[model samples]
Target: MTLLRGLVLLSLCLASGQSAGDQPAPAGSQNAPCPLLSVNDPVQRDRLLYHTCYLSQPTDLGDWRQITPAQLPAQLKWQASNGEQLAFPRSQLEYWIRLNLKNDGPTPGFWYLALDYAPVDYVSFTLHRANGSSVIETGDQRPFDARGIDYRYYLVPISLNAGEAATLYLRLSSQGALNLPLSLLTPDELVAQSNTLTLTHGLFYGALIIFALFNLLLFISSGTRYYFFNAFYMASLGLFLFAMGGFAYQHLWPGSPWLANTAVPLSMALCALAINLFGRSFLQVRRQSPLTSRLMTAQTGIACGLLVLALALPYNHAIAIITVAALALICSLFFIGVIRWRQGHSHAKWYVLSWSLMVLGTLTYALAAFGYIPDFLQQEMIMQSAIGGQVLLLNYAIVQRWRDMQKRLWLAENRAKMRLEREVAERTTQLQDAMRDLEAANQRLEALSTRDSLTGLHNRRYLDGRLTELIREAHRHLRPLALVVLDADHFKRINDHYGHAVGDLCLRHIADELKHAVHRPQDVVARFGGEEFALLLPDTDLAGAQRVTNQFLQRLASCPAGQREGLHIPLTLSAGVALLQADETQAQLFERADSALYRAKAGGRNQLVVAGNTPAPVGTATNRNRE
Candidate 1:
């Protein structure tokens, strides 16, 4: 690289002919004789003379003169190698030139002459009118050229007339100097070249900056690492383009030569890294699918190779690095499509088409840059086609990616809504089941409140309520109503002797005996208290009640007291009977029956007591008897 730079510097120094301090003169030089003529006629003659003098430098060194129309007849005797004598009519001549020049060296500078003519004469010179307007002649000489020799040449402004001939001399002073040709340009062409370069570069850079900003905004809005990578990639591509020796940087930042050089490799490296990272994220290459992983590895290798090449070569290698990177990017896009296809990503088709168009554009640019096409074709046609197509493809890719993201977001939202609804439905079902269980438990609690738990019989609350209706019915019909209260004797003793299990059995036996002894449907048997029971008879007299109580007593006496492994013990029950009295409340009747039960207990155990024809007092003992 240092050798190349030194060689370039040597070439520049040799061509410039100085140590950069001297200004070289412009390339051409010319000499010619003066003429006498009306300035107006000479202007027309000189205009034609300059038209041919612009072609080349010739070898003859003298015999160049400008003449007026009056001298045209005498000058017509001159003949040369072509065997053609100069001829002029007296009225046709205005101005003319006889010229000779040495073509031994390079083309010479511009020369001019003012000439007059009379009558008729015609003179011609060879010079090309490169650019600018031709005007009528005046007395003063203007710049022109007599053309010949190997190097390039041009004609400056010169004038001639109709009645005279002008003689101009052309000289050659240097070799290999080319003229700054402007033969093809018009006024509008000159203006366009001067102005459009800046405007074109401005628009290019402006578009690049806008695209970079758009990617940056996407990165910030989405918080996706891929978007960030794309942003960096685009920015680096913009910087790389600016760093290249293009009209954009030439017109916009011409003074920043150091920045220009640094941007080359730096942007190359950054772009390579950005593209590598973007590929990894965009293709989900780390998911360990074999083909995707292999493709990613290959892309990484290519990117690394590009970086190494950029670092090792001269800075101008930025162009090669960018080209290689573009190729790698194209390949990566293809592999991404493959991965997406394998993974069942529906949007890959659009992405693939978009990148394919971009790759085509990039390949076109690459071909043009390498001089595979004409300069006019590359600059005016291929470049525009490539850039325009690539931009459209990039926009298409952006829209496709946006639509894919929107679809993913919509699916995620739908899934979340479904999950929430499912949870709500499940909770509602659970609440309904819980309410049903609670209602069942409430019904069980109500049943337990009125019934006896131990023997499954009506409790004291039932007995008390039924006894009142029995007494009222008996009083209305003047019939008999009777009550019997019974107790299991020696129940606590049974519990102490054989455990509470046998004591519970003893109570159950006594309850069974009492239920069996009550034969009437109107009679209700109930557990009155811990070891006590009651029987109410709605249509029975006191005698009938006494007889039923005695029967219950006998049945209890016959029941087994306890059973332990099939061994039996004797168990007995005691009872008291009462007849319903007129004007007596049910509580009074129950008190009398309770008193009779105690009397039976007092007269020895396992016996029945009947209420006698005595006033039923609260604490009086009734008649007692053993059954």
Candidate 2:
């Protein structure tokens, strides 16, 4: 089925090309780019002919699982490949490498296949024998311990029988740069190259560690957020390099195949986030350039979002996001440097120099990743050098910033000394003015604290304190005091219908009604909460409070909805009246009144219920007209 699908796909590609009238291969296509690499004839101890194999990649992102060896012949005729490390434009395509190898040597031994572009996520190599059979497997995708040899990339052994002529088919897929720099090496040669690569990696890792530690200590000593961000950025960069260069797979996380797969994009995403923060803080982007500052903030958010996507999405999707974000971040940094440079930031010159190198190396590496160029340019090395320069330049920038701050502080001190006498006289006047203002503000605050701003009635705090004093006087004199608790019925309807402005006006209208209903100067009215109001009538009996409540309700009904736009929308409220009992505490009296209030609401609104009393006469309590 796989072979059949491959054949169908190949046929479809050719038919579409013809249908579109795509130009055909130029006249008598020249000889194959390079003869199939002969394994039997060793080219040199460490050097050999770089065979340019035939190549084909899926045109779509759909499954290429149907590709099989039976379709190998179809791809063999497609085209010849050229270059030590071929690059392709950014694509989510799967590629096939076709080559022929003859063991022209005397004996057969193990041959190691290596891929220099270590970040390529998955690779497959199949050795076809004279029989219809073949040996097929994959690289990089497999666990490090599972590889034929314990090396990064695809280190598989190809056991070619003496005098055997075998065809090799390799499949490559990745979310990162798509570079295919294939090398067939004897065991000794492979080890030698791996060791040389390891040494170079050690130097890079060592420098990263030093930078991270130095910045961390600098942050600790100076208490600056900038150094911490710088340290984190360097650490993330180290991890990214390790993941990309395959060192993380070999050493740090060999057991975590998931981490090995996700580490590059994750670390790079984090590195972008940290580096952006470091740049913002180092240059004071917010204070220096407000518009650019917002752009920087947005890019940082994007990098952070990509970090999550990297861990969750497939490598192909994650890589595409990381690549775009990476490009945007680099551009954003370059823009910041340019803005600061225009503003005459002294350290911005070195900052620009640093970012220029970094940008060049990043673009070159990214271009190769997308298959726009060959991989021989040592992009990884160039990026490493550029980043190192940036760290140094940023350190210098930090020092310069410190110096500038110190100079400003010194100038401020000198100005202070020159203004000492005048400042002392001014300070005396300010102190006298401050004392007068403080006294006036205290008086205003006292009024504000005691009164409700909305209704000009007593607030809850003032109500509680004043109620305590009134209760003490009532108990001491052996006199009666009545508590009237009024709750607006269906007040939410009023607010919902008329809006809160009129709702508040209606409340103030009720407050004024309570004040006008009072016959004695000692009657205190206060807004309880929301649309509820409370009244304390000292030296009053239940009958006297009952009469006052009737008067208050009548006044309330007369001014409905506070005459909004000259229209009176009426609202009703229920009330409970409780006359203080002998030795009753303030809380006990409040509870009795509250219970009566609920009973009034339960019976019907616009009515008053008296604790220890049946109710006001039916017509008197329940006869208020509803709006």
Candidate 3:
């Protein structure tokens, strides 16, 4: 690489008539004669025209035929170039560069003269050899096919016979910065360099397109305004870079020179507008400071106006205006990001960092264009690198914003759930109280339905129910059950002599005595009707039934039946008992007991009779039980 660089420097020194050991001529030398560039060695395939001479003209000079080499020496004064490239600020003047070539070898030379810059408006190449003169004109101002060689940059072929010399003149005109980095190469070197450049540009543009599509998908799914604006910004930045780098002119609108020229300024304006919108939304500028928000709005409006004027104004004027507007937009976005970050906006720190990178790159490129700074790096490469970094940072900021939102939503849901639980607990307590009160009322109704109101004992209905249940138990478990039916003896006579009220009192007195005799919890005592009573006993045999009736008769004989208002009324009861037999139904058992009671009443006033047995005197039953 060092040897190659030395060779390049030697060739440049030879073009200015200086050897490797000699000092370079001064920059003010305009009258020195230009040296003949010798293509003598076939091994030396590449050369750079670093020390070319140039003549400036204010307007179009009629034709190339009017400026032959013989007349040009007296008609114009050519100035020597100071560096490898010829750089000038944007201008309307035309520049003419001169190179004198000679093939001093035995073989003829076939070489390509090329210009690396693409945005020059018009370039005309004129070659005058010993054989004939040729002229070729092509630039972004002309259709792409108008070029003699089909390539992105300006390239033309030149040939010189052995021992023959040629004079070549190039005319350049543009409405943008004029940078001429001219080179002469063999066919092999041209092809190699073109391939290298194509690969580099492909990777750069591919990265920009990927970022653009990725942000577009995010915007569609999330419906975030900032994401939409970010996608638009990336797309416009890519398009502007494409046009500025000549890719759009070569590939997109090669047939239309006007479109090629207009795309640069228009795309740049769109980029400015999109960035302003993205920054405003990402930072929530309106919520933070209304004044800053309005300023961004105005900047967007200016960018939109520039978009319309880019086609209407001259290319130089439109590009200049758009460049200034874009710089202002970037700076303002950076300023707003700083303000928001200081105010505690969560996403604004990333915004500030990203815009800071963009602002640095854009400022450097702009300063180079306006001739205020050296072009240390290629403007396109610097901007592309900065934009890639900014895109990644901003995407991260959006992700952080989404996470914050999700957290807030989760917190709100938890609070609502806690409130609902409190309400549910209160409702549950109220329902428990209501259920407790309902249970108490149901217990009272149950007591009224099953108990006799007058005797405070099981009524006839309860007796019937118990009788059926006890009969089922006796059949299933082989247990004895007894039922007794009894009637109040001489009850009608008491009512006739002492009044009905006294008779009721005597019946109650008889019921009290019967209740006291049957003290077992398994026994059920009930009033059968007026002046009649029944007893249901579970697990009781015939002998047990006889004993219970005898005891009740003995107790009643010792006590007065009824006493009211100092009047006494006598009462006696005749009872019959039946034991539950095998396979006995409730109706059959009740019929047998009623039959025994009827017999007891027929035999005498008061006696106990057992079903399937003869009647026994109440006194005899009591005495037999005692013995």
Return the top candidate by TM-score: 3
lDDT of each: 0.52, 0.71, 0.74
Deviation of model 1 at 119, angstroms? 60
Off by over 4 Å in 1: 1-188, 194-200, 248-269, 283-294, 297-305, 315-322, 338-346, 376-381, 423-435, 438-627
Candidate 2 residue 38 C-alpha distance from true site, Å: 3.1
Worst-scoring 10-residue span by lDDT in model 2: 19-28
Model 1: lDDT to the true structure: 0.52
Give model 1's TM-score versus the native structure. 0.38
TM-score ranking, high to low: 3, 2, 1
Compare the candidates by lDDT and give the number of the best one: 3
RMSD per candidate (Å) reads 31.9, 24.0, 26.0
Residue-wise C-alpha lDDT for candidate 3, range 430-538, written one tens digit per residue: 8556656899865665555556656666777788888888888777777777789999887777888888777777767877887888877788888868888998877
- Which digits, one per residue and each the tens of the lDDT, describe model 1 over residues 1-627? 332343343334323333221221211123322222222333433333233222121213232234222333432332221211111111111223334321121332222331211101112333322232232321101111112111111222343222333334222211111111112222343346537655765676677667767777887987877767766766776666554323323444444444434455566666667667765676566774667777667866776776666656644344444555655566567667756856776556655665565555545444333222222223433444454455455556656767787999999999999999999889867865775689886566645455676776678888878877777776676666778888877778878988887777777766766678766567798997989888887666666667777766676666675454585868777788887776778887888888888998998979988866455422123422212
Write the number of the candidate with greater lDDT, choosing between 2 and 3.
3
Please provide, for model 2 over 1-627, each residue's C-alpha lDDT reduced to its tens digit, 9 standing for 90 to 100. 332343343234322423211221112223455456677557631233245454545455355556666654443454454433455433345666666777777787668766676766567667777875554454456677765556666665677777887777777766444666667888888889779877877787898899899989999998999889989988988888778777789888777767887887788799889889988888888876788789889988888898899889987567656766675686668777877888877777676777776666666565555444454337667777777777777677777777877887999998998799689879867865775679887566655576787888888888888889988887777676789999998989889988998888888877777777775657788887888889988777767788878877877776676565785888778999997776777898899999999999999889999987342322232233211
Candidate 2: regions farther than 4 A off? 1-34, 40-50, 57-78, 106-110, 129-136, 159-164, 175-177, 255-257, 287-289, 421-627
lDDT of 1 at 510: 69
